[model samples]
Target chain A: GAGVSQSPRYKVAKRGQDVALRCDPISGHVSLFWYQQALGQGPEFLTYFQNEAQLDKSGLPSDRFFAERPEGSVSTLKIQRTQQEDSAVYLCASSPDRVVPISGNTIYFGEGSWLTVV
Target chain B: SQQGEEDPQALSIQEGENATMNCSYKTSINNLQWYRQNSGRGLVHLILIRSNEREKHSGRLRVTLDTSKKSSSLLITASRAADTASYFCATYFSGSARQLTFGSGTQLTVLP
Candidate 1:
């Protein structure tokens, strides 16, 4: 894909149900990120992957949230026992490289997956 | 936790007027970036300002960063109705790879 792609643009799940969101980053991109945005708020950081390594998961919010990028390209964010608070738009982004002095690392974002926990 | 916070939760202005949004952060950052979101969809990257650079301009957008104050401001000149969107400021720490911590954001409405 020319840009980051996310699946199931919108999902409605009942409370306690599990859900999975998928993201396919730009081809050959080295960095991928996941963010959650609530209504009228900015996207909050969830996790980051450098290729296949899960480097940071500090912002996952809780143990119910899990993310993996096994092959260093496609990534999935899984939420177990979803709660009402889990309702938000899940955004996926990818950057070509890490931050360096001369080159700016600009991330391209996907349209996002809107999850509604009923 | 959120690293940046934007001011003027909402702003309304006529087309052609300049729109200015401010963002403040708590800690040191390697770089700061601005992003725009239309409706509730994806975010588009606007510009980036490094810690050493004080100001940068791209097209009609101007970004200023003050490391001492731990803040940055985005100025969109000659705004148009198409520019109506929510603007966010995100920060990346020095050692962090490319991960960004974003602020709440400011909703800007351009009246035609």
Candidate 2:
């Protein structure tokens, strides 16, 4: 893909139900990131991956949230036992090369997976 | 926790007027980036200013960084209705550059 792609653009999950959002980053981009944005708020970092290595998962809100990029290209963010507070847009972004936003590398974001917990 | 906080929580102006938004951070950052998000849409990267750089310009956007003051400002020249959106400032920490930490954001409305 020419840019980052996210699947399940919108999802409605009942409380306690689980949901999975998928992300396909730009080809050959080694860094991927996930963010959660509530209504009228800025996106917050959820997690980050450097290729297949989950270098940082410190930003995950709780144990119920899990993310993985096994092959270093496609990633999935799974929210288990979803709660009402989990209602937010999950954004996937990717940048070229080894790190986040070095000098010249630009980070591109997907349209996001909107999750509505009802 | 969020590293930056953008201000003028909300602003409204005419299409031809200029709009400026400011941001302040609490830590040493490797770089700061500005992003704009439309309602219910994704964010678009606007501009970036490294810690060593004081300012940068792109199209109608101008970004200024003051590491010593831990602040930055984004100025939009000749705002348009299409420029009405929420702007956010994100920081990549010098010690932690794996991801970006975003701010609360500023909602700018440009009336045509």
Candidate 3:
């Protein structure tokens, strides 16, 4: 793909319903990340993956929030029992594989999946 | 609180004026990045400055980093009304390699 791609640009789910957002990272990129951005706020980290292995998920707000990058190319963020507070844009970003942060690979982001729990 | 915090929650400027936004981080960072977002749109990467680099310029955008002060600034020269958007600073924590912590961001409005 030309850039990070996300599905269901907008979603409306009833409270307590489950919703799934998909992301396809840029081709050949080795690092992928997911974030949640509430209105009027910056995007917050949700999880990170180095290849297919999930290295960090401490930022996931609760047990209901889960993300996985199955092939290290495509990822999915699933929210179970969505709440009103969960209404926000779920962002998917990817970066080239770099062993260290100082190496500084640019992180590209998707247009994001806007989820609104009514 | 997030690792990074941006100053001036909101900024209003006329077109052709220069706009500068600041970011402060609490901990050492490997690199700092700036992004722009328009209403209801995804973020667009502006620039990234490494800890070792004091400054970097790309087109009309200039970025400065001060590791000692744990701060960075983004200066947009000759701003345009199309430049109206929210600006954010994200940091790669020295201890964390993959996670990018973002600040609250500054909403910049450039009036024509």
Candidate 4:
């Protein structure tokens, strides 16, 4: 794909149900990131992946949230025992190389996966 | 936790007028970026300002960064109806983790 792609653009899950969102970054993009945006708020950092390495997961809200990028290209964010508070738009972004914006390093975003946990 | 916070949660102006948004951060950053989102969809990259550079321009967008004050401002000259959207400021730390920490954002409405 020419840009980042996300799966299940909209998802509605039961309170206790589990859900998984997928993201396919641009070809050869070395950095991938996941963020959660609530209604009328900004996108909060969830996790980051440099290649296949899960370098940072500190921003993830809780242990129920898990992310993985096994092949260094496609990534998945899984939420177990979903809660209403988890309802938000999950955004996935990718950068061609390291995030040194001074040298024109820009991150491209996907349409995002909107999850509604009832 | 969020690193940046934008001011003036919402703004409305005529199409020909200019729009200005401000952002402030708490800690040091490697770089700051601006993004635009429409109708709750994907976000588009607008501009970037590094910690060392004070100002940068791209087309009609001008960005200024002040490391000492930990603040940045975005100025849109001659706004258009198409420019109505939510603008966000994101900061990338100067460490190993390369992800961005975003602010609440400003909603700008350009009336035609």
The native-contact fractions of the candidates, in order shown, are 0.61, 0.68, 0.68, 0.67
Clashing residue pairs in candidate 4 are none
Regions more than 4 Å wrong, model 4: A100-104
Chain B TM-score (model 1 vs. true structure): 0.95
Itemize residue pairs with steric clashes in candidate 1.
Answer: none
The candidate 1 chain A region of ten consecutive residues with least summed lDDT is A96-105
Per DockQ, the best of the predicted structures is: 3
Q: Mind giving the per-residue lDDT tens digits that candidate 3 earns over B1-112?
A: 4788899999999999999999999998888999999898888888988889999999999999998999999999999999999999998898777778899999999999
- Models, CA RMSD each: 1.6, 1.3, 1.3, 1.5
Q: Count the backbone clashes (under 3 Å) in each candidate.
A: 0, 0, 0, 0
What DockQ does each prediction reach against the true complex? 0.60, 0.67, 0.71, 0.63
Tens-digit lDDT track for model 3 on A1-118? 7989999999999999999999999998898989999998899989988899999998899999989888878999999999999999999988887436776777888999999999
Candidate 3 residue-wise lDDT at A116: 93
Task: Assess each prediction's global lDDT (C-alpha) against the native.
Answer: 0.91, 0.91, 0.91, 0.91
The TM-scores that each candidate's chain B achieves against the reference are 0.95, 0.97, 0.97, 0.96
Q: Flag clash pairs in model 3.
A: none
